[model samples]
Target chain A: MSVLEVNHVSKSFGSNTILQDINLAFEENKIYGLLGRNGAGKSTLLNIMTNRIFPDAGDVKLDSENINDNDTKLGLMYLMSEVNLYSNGTTLKQIISDTELMYGDFDHSFAARLIDEFGIDINQKFGKLSTGYNSIFKLILALCVPVKFVLLDEPVLGLDANHRELFYSELIQSYSDNPRTFIISTHLIEEVANIISDVIVLDQGRIMLDQPVEDVLAKTHSVVGPAKDVERYTKGLNVIGHDTMGTIKANYVYGDLDDRPLPDTVQLSNFDLQKLFIFLTNKYEGSMHSEN
Target chain B: MKTNQVTKYLFKKQIVLLGELYLFAFAIIFLLPLLLSVISGTLSDYSFVGLLKGAHIAALFGIFMIAISTLSYENFKFLIQNGISRKTFFEAQLTVYGILILIGNTINLFYDYLIVVPLTHASTFNTFMSLYADFFDNPFVSVTFNFIFSALLLVFGALAGMTVGSFMTLFSKLTQRIILIATPVVGVVTMAYVANATNNAHYQMSWVVNFAKFIIGENGNDVLNPFPMMGFLLVLSAIMIVIIRYLFAKKQLKKA
Candidate 1:
């Protein structure tokens, strides 16, 4: 299996750092959810990996070969950035045709189907497309390009509820049909929770958590009930965060549970991916503030 | 990635643009004379081919090149999004311009002979052949001289256009604004000073005339050899190409 590796990558704009010694490895045939807060270096990391921007320190390698300025290796991956790089006057059909030419291979039939389903006029200029259609067209490109790895940054930026759901379904179908690696960085966590096999979380220029979605969800629990009982039951565990309402409280813990008997009016249950992500990122960010 | 393929694509686009320009120029070049003849009933008096000469072609080609340079930013964004590296992008852009400089000069030469020469019975219509053709006994040698002279001018003009284009695209907005503001201010000040009848201004104007004489190899009665002008163009173009390449390599792309 082919793998993409980022070795000790660090990036900054001026004196303000964006990514700090970030190290990551993504293998083939896996869907990864890259979660990060606003300005958490998610876009910068994706851009650096694709060589859209350079990293100040370290390099990106694919299959142990340096991909920097290497056309053969760079051709095997694609990054659908948030900004549209195609000319404004170019029609969608022309853009698709040019993209196919550049990549040397494209799923024309699949692209046609997506274009039709999305009700996009192929003859209309890219500049004329609304924000939703722009994102739709970009995502279609991300899914259709015949590459080993597809990195999507804000894939559903302007997508509506219906379109987002359609996109997720199509994404799963495409993965099942093609079996390529996908690294999707987005703020919509609950939606991609069940879709991505692995989750990598970033907070304040650091990798806060990287684990399989199932493992992350399994280790995470919400101790809900009376405030005192919940606190007692969750004491000494990795209590990342909590929500309290008067006498009642729910503690979000992320670790192995103790074998102690449950006290009266205290209950324990599993938490979703979004809650765990929130807890992890908020804890690290809060810690940074406290340290400062 | 696939730098050759990308270069070929860019070259084709430039050719298409050039072809459109040729079509427009040809229409105006050929049709305007006929229109004037119909309206005023006199065609022999009007200078048709002389209106467009080698220097004029150089200026037109320079403008075409400047336009191409302005598009470099948009092209860079598109190509980078398609996974083309900066090195490949620079190589492809230079290659396209290098090829265009040759091809464009040849096409201009072809048009001058095929269209302009037949229209006017004049022996020499281009800047080089107008003054320097007497040195060459044969018409073929004179035409070749015209081609070389025009090509050298085209290259120098292209370098100038690329400089302007690179400046506009590669630099920060503030830097561009400062340069834009300063160039005209400096130009107007120098023009005002040089326009004066002072002895210093006359000395400066005489120096310019002497430089022109040296370029033309003119001692009032000698053959105007173009070797000096060719050498000057080649050296200046080499230096400007280096500066342009440095700017290309060092440029950090913006999000816009």
Candidate 2:
């Protein structure tokens, strides 16, 4: 069953609409990636889904009930990138105590273990911590909070390479152990591409693409060959993206790659998420060829 | 977690915010008196009794600062975003701010007795206590009156600040930028008005003397008892709090 449903939701600031008629459904026990460009209303959508921001129109429901209902039965948690814990004079230990008090299922032991693993100082004030550590601290709390639906918005924005790897590892482990619905909204598509079971691409406050990772991957492929041959072979195909180097050309094609073998001068390659995202998002200016 | 669970989280946030405000209050209270004494070239003969009285008045400034600092645009935005009922959040902040001010006053009074008294003259402690006794002589009447007046000032300040903060948050970025420039100008105008109202020749002004009477009690000759005024202030404050809470609850959490 779907764990989250947003139905024709719209949000406007004064007369300027930020999100319009956005609709989506998310299932349980799956890792979903929410991909969008900046100001595409990705965070706004997440905020509305998590009940942080109310929609101007329509409704967002969790477990078949309006999320704003005071039932206390729906387990939902949102970790926003902007709404951080107190930055100054609050120790990690104090934050843990406060979290435990706030979240009934907050696991202190798990938090402590994560803190140790992340090498965070228990006595250091949150304000004094580096940006990477600050993000880690929030991540630790987010993971330990036992909520059925967890929404993480750009969780790795400020982390170092090593910490990002560590965070992803911990996130995967936590999801495996808990089996909850996790919606991760990020611009770093390539980093989370392999782990995301489902993908939702948002563009201009609307769902541009929503499908299982396998289905999405299946529809996209890259063809590389001599420039002239590659162009000729992909002439009638839906080309999402393309690149060229001198006489060589590479093209990202949408739809079944297995239905047709590569031409003699062309080689077929599997599409990666980075290339796919670039192709899908950068397809506006005649970058994608229509099958017509 | 239950709805009550969020209260605990909010209280923790309140404590952290209050601590910062308390420190800010202390710095202002301690520094102002010292700065005034130095500027007057009376540092050598600075009377502890005078300093104690000044500190008491300075401590009251914390109520204003607390009102301004706590009801910030970001805080209101946060309260709305977190799904905290505005009534609950406002009451929580008021409760927290009241507690912090009381604690801050106690500390200021203590520091007056300990440091200021010793630095100037220990003999003046009795005089200071007498003044305090005179100020708080009729415990039931004086306490009721002062409490009501203080609560009114706090609520008024908080509401005004919240109104401005909310406006800033709801307005466009360009408007906010403009208001950022106008804020200090508005502040200066308010100070000028206050100065004119409290000038010596205008000391008999009904509002001025009424406010002073609430703070320091009747100046021995005043025939008007402040009990009714106290009751009126209390009722007004309660009404304002309710209105502010209602507005805040219904207001949208618009982003800047």
Best DockQ among the predictions, by candidate number: 1
Model 1 steric clash pairs: none
| Candidate 2: clashing pairs of residues | none
lDDT of 1 by residue, B1-256 (tens): 5878678867877888888986777667767776888789887766654555422554566678767765677777777677776678777887888799788888767767876667665666667877787877888887887888887777777777766766676676788888889999999998877677545567657878898888776767778777877888888889988887766655556644
lDDT of 2 by residue, B84-194 (tens): 444555556556556555554555445655666566664333322433334455656554544444445554555555555544555666888888999899999999987
lDDT of 2 at B94: 58
Error of 2 at B12 (Å): 5.6
Residue B247 shift from truth in candidate 2, angstroms: 5.0
Q: Give the chain B TM-score achieved by candidate 1.
A: 0.78
Q: lDDT per residue, candidate 2, A1-292, as tens digits?
A: 6568889999886786788898888888999999987887888887777555568899977778776533242345545454553546778887677556545667777787788888989898877978788888878877887677778888987788988998999899999888888899998898999999999888667777899999988888688999988888888898888888989999889877445556898988688766777666756423334533
